[model samples]
Target: MTLRAGVLGLGVMGRHHSRVLNELEGVEFKGVYDPSDAVPSHIEGKPVVRDLDTFLDMGFDYCVVAAPTIYHLEIGTMLASRGIHALIEKPVASTSEAANELRDLFTAAGLVGGVGHIERYNPALQSARQRIQDGLLGDIYQVTTRRQGPFPGRIADVGVIKDLATHDIDLTAWVTQQEYVSINARTTFRSGREHEDMVLAIGTLSKGTIVSHTVNWLTPFKERTTIITGEHGSLVADTLTADLTYFENGVRHHQWDDISQFRGVSEGDVTRFALDKKEPLRAEHEAFRDAVLSGDTSAIVTLAQGAAVVATAEKFVADGLEHRLTTP
Candidate 1:
């Protein structure tokens, strides 16, 4: 049976998802929903339902909710209550309490719930994680991520930490397999919005690994990079370029007792891996569809995990608030 799927909110990102869902196998793009002034010309010309209740009434087996942040809890809770599978956008909600409520709602309904953590499906990230897990990055010491770009819109309601840094937060946790025990964050706002335009955060894991993240929407160019420093070497991953560079240079035992016998560090081999094919979004859509069909949630990041990412981000935001001495 063809899996009937509908996408909610066909804005910029939702439109991209609309295109990929159609191309993916075993997915029948039943319709799309967006209250915007315009709608896409494709998707078998299904109705762009203007009513939430009526839209949910239609025979959509599952949903891909790319709606705005505020509407996430409302629409997601509604669909999840109806036992419909959902893949909501990141930051799950504005707060951890709300995020967990949605997770519990889905769990209670026995429905599959996932998030659009598109970065998790990146081939480069996947490869890097595999290497790290394979002991390539023996005893990781620190991980740093940088995501900067020219300001994007609709981010006034949310800060750079939630809008941009959340990706790295989730990525760092996944790659390093650690939970943030503590976080210290600072923010700067130039857009005059309640949200911060630039944010820097540092998190320490129980494993003694330190992770620092830099997120800014006011940069001159677009950059998506993650650097992981392990005991043996360091890895530089560029999502935009689809490349991973590994550097092996670190301190070693020196025969200094032999009077000026410090051996110079050897600039170890640098290897760059190419992501041959497969768009991450398309892969993510396919994974979601298959997981739904198989009734397994292994491949896709579970709603609970996604909520945890939001939880950490929430902590960062809260830390920022505390730093400014506001009762957030």
Candidate 2:
């Protein structure tokens, strides 16, 4: 059965969602709902709807809520009321309360709802998660992520923690199958924006695994890297290039007296696995589509998970604010 799908935004991510929905298998691209005068009247040869009610009447089995963070709760509530499934973008809502409401609404309505945490679909991360699960990384110790890039002018509603660090929060928990237990963070408003432009967060997970995230909008170049260090070795995943490298812990004893005095483990062989680098966006769409088709949600990030990430981000912001720093 071919399911009908529509998109709710026409911004950068929304445009890409429209294009992918138009080409996705077993899915019929219905159109889009973006009242912005700036958005064109058509996208992917489909009409760009101007009215919310009119767009709802188009009969979509599922809708992609690619609208800004502010509109997620409204759009999701409307979709749930209409008995339509929804795939809301990450950070599920502007606030944890809003996200929980959306989650409860969809759950009560018995509709398929997922959050768009696209990093979970990245091939390198996916491979890393699998390997870690398979005991390749025995006794996971730490997860460190660095996601830095120049600020995108399109974002204005949220700060770096919510905008970028949410990716690390969700991905770290997912890769290790653990939830954050506590977090402390520091933030700076270097860009003169209402929201912070840079953040450094460190937290412990439910399994006692420590994690740290370094995210900012002031970097000169873009970097999307996650390093998972465990008992046996470390797995480095570069999501930017979809590469996964494994550094095995050295088992041989050092010959030099100075080298042998090192307390920590030494590096052994390094192997970069060949991965099928599929477009993460397309993979995400496929996972959501499959979830909508079947009654299974294991493949997609649930709204609850997304809401938890938002809560963690809020904690980071609050912690940063509580411990204000002054320099002489």
TM-score of predicted model 1? 0.93
What is the C-alpha lDDT profile of model 2 across 2-105, one tens digit per residue?
99999999999999999999999999998999999999999999999999999999899999999989999999999999999999988799999999999899
Q: What is the C-alpha RMSD of each candidate to the true structure, in Å?
A: 2.8, 1.7
lDDT of each: 0.83, 0.95
Runs in model 1 lying further than 4 Å from the true structure: 40-45, 250-255, 258-265, 325-328
Model 1 scores worst on lDDT over the 10 consecutive residues at: 258-267
Best model per lDDT: 2
Which numbered prediction scores highest in TM-score against the true structure?
2
Residue-wise lDDT of candidate 1 within 1-328, one digit each (tens)?
Answer: 7898899987778778878877768887877877665665455456677767777777788999988887889989888778789989887777788889988999889898888888988877888899999998798989989899999875555788877888998889889888889999988767778888888899898799998888898899999999898877888888886788888775556566764475445567787776665788988998889888998998888889888988999888888877874436
Stretches > 4 Å off in candidate 2: 254-263, 326-328
